[model samples]
Target: MAVIPVALAGRSYEVRVGSGLLADVAGQCGKLLRKQRVPIVTDSNVAGLWRDTVATSLEAAGKEPRWLVLDPGEGAKSWRVLERVMDWLLDEEVERGDHILALGGGVIGDLTGFAASIMKRGCGFVQLPTTLLAQVDSSVGGKTAINTSAGKNLVGAFHQPGLVLADLATLDTLPVRETRAGYAEVIKYGILGDRAFFDWCETEGPKVMAGDKAAQDYAVTESVKAKARIVAEDERETTGARALLNLGHTFGHALEAETGFSDRLLHGEGVALGMVLAARYSARRGYISEADGERVVAAIGASGLPISIAALGMDADGRKLANHMLHDKKMDSGTLPFVLLRGVGEAFLDKQVALDDIAHFLDEQLKTA
Candidate 1:
């Protein structure tokens, strides 16, 4: 197992990446298991695939595993389901000293982490992320929240997990579409900061997605390391350092809102398309060469992700898309900050971007796409 430390002073934790980590979770988490029972929250889809392995592992360690399976999808991140999870955790009598295990993708990790953040004023929790997206991005970061009518992740907290088990073996069970969606995030790391990593992905990304264990481990580990450094420097996003992680998120979240946060467009797919938009917009502003913009799109498309807004089949214009972006969390003093690329591997936050310009640019893109 490769261990990456998230050094956050008192709230620090380790993200463990490798195969069979789930089956050996009890051993790794034994020190943090203050109580005989650990409460696990997961979704329906992951329940069938991993419930047994987790339960049997805890059982062997003499720890009682109590689980609550929720309905799968983005809908599970609503207020109603959050209340249900709270009630279940309360009924389980989980204490501050005891840790709750979130075993699934981003939805489960976000919901469970938020629940633990507020339960009894604040309790400990563990992240056993199953999906590729969760393992690389959402699982490591302490940003946890539920979607409200206002916007996505508008209501959430920054509660770090006690430990994160990112078993690469779980990716073997994920569908091709979901795996490709996660690769978008992996590429985002390179686009935002590291030119060499982006070059590496150009060659090894296909192999990583093809179930090459070594390639997948390197990708996940490198991605996690990048996140750990940023998080440790800016835990609460006070400094602009951590915002670089949102390379394609501003445009991506707007696209997600326009799509009704439905399965019609996965979060990573929106992000993949959003990165293309960010790149092109950067090129339009003369921040990067047109060739670099096309390079970004080519990498995303090669991974089988969407590179244009037209592919989503949405009847949206630039004005409509910009309106959705008004709800973005990155808005500062009524001005929305956009993560635009200077070139491949060089993303910077631009706080002075005019929304009107974004609408016009997106309008051009929609027509061309």
Candidate 2:
């Protein structure tokens, strides 16, 4: 087991990555499980797979497990479901000192964390991230949010988890498509800052997706370590340091909105394609050579993730897609700062990005093969 600390002053926590953490859920959580009745929020899919393991673990520890299983999907991260979760927690008589367990993918973690953040003016929560995307990215970061009609993750808060148990065993049940999508975020850590890690990914990415345990462990642990370092430096995204983490998110969120945030494009899929766009756009702006932009596209494409917006089969044009970014949460004083690449491992924030120029460039991209 690899235990990486998210050093956040008084609220620091550990993100443990390994196999069978879920089997020892009670022992892993330790003192965080303070009450006899432990409140756990998860999606029905996750409950079907690992509920018994968690239940048995807590039960063996003399704790009664209380389960609130939600419908699984992006739709669950909404105002309506949040109200339901909040009401359920209320019925459980949860107090501010109580730690709620979020036992699923990013959706469960985000919604449960958001609920805990506002519950009695901030309670504690632990993240049992089941999916690769959640374990590597969302679970460690304190950014919890629900998607509003205006945009994805429009309603949320920065509520850090007390503990994060990323059990690698859970990845065994993930579909190949989901695993490939999750690889997008895995590669993202490399693309944003570490050229060495990016090189490592270029060769070993296939091994990670193939479910090789050693590869999976290295990928998850390294990604978490990078996130922990960045997040510790800028907890609330007040500094531009945290914004680097959004390397592909701005463009990715726009693609998500254009697709109605449905199964047509998973979040990680959008991010994979978004990074390609960011790289290509960076080349257009002369920040990087065309060959380097193609390098980014090739690496993402080799992993079987979508590398082009043209392939999405959307009826929308560049103007429509660019317009969707208008509601982006990152928009400041009518200018949206973009995370563009200076080189493979050099990402910088460009606040001078114009939506109009983006529309024109996207129009060109839309017409391509």
Write candidate 2's Cα lDDT for 1-369 as tens digits.
999999988999999999999999999999999999999999999999999999999999999999999999999999999999999999999999999999999999999999999999999999999999999999997999999999999889999999999999999999998899899999999999999999999999999999999999999999999999999998888889999999889889989998898989999999998899999999999999999899999999999999878888889888899998999998989999999999998999999998999999998888777
TM-score of each: 0.99, 0.99
What's the CA error at residue 363 for candidate 1, in Å? Answer: 0.9
Per-residue lDDT of candidate 1, residues 1-369 (tens digit): 899999998988999999999999899897898878889999889999999999999999999999899999999999999999999999999888889999999999999999999999999999999988999999997999999887899889999999999999899999999999999999999999999999999999999789899999999999999999999999998899998898888889889998999998898998898899999999999999999999999999999999989767788898998998888888889998888989788989899899999999988888776
What is the C-alpha local distance difference test score of candidate 2?
0.95
Local lDDT at 108 for model 1: 97
RMSD of 1: 0.8
Q: Estimate every model's Cα lDDT from 0 to 1.
A: 0.92, 0.95
In model 2, residue pairs whose N, Cα or C atoms come closer than 3 Å (at least 3 residues apart or on different chains), thus clashing, are none
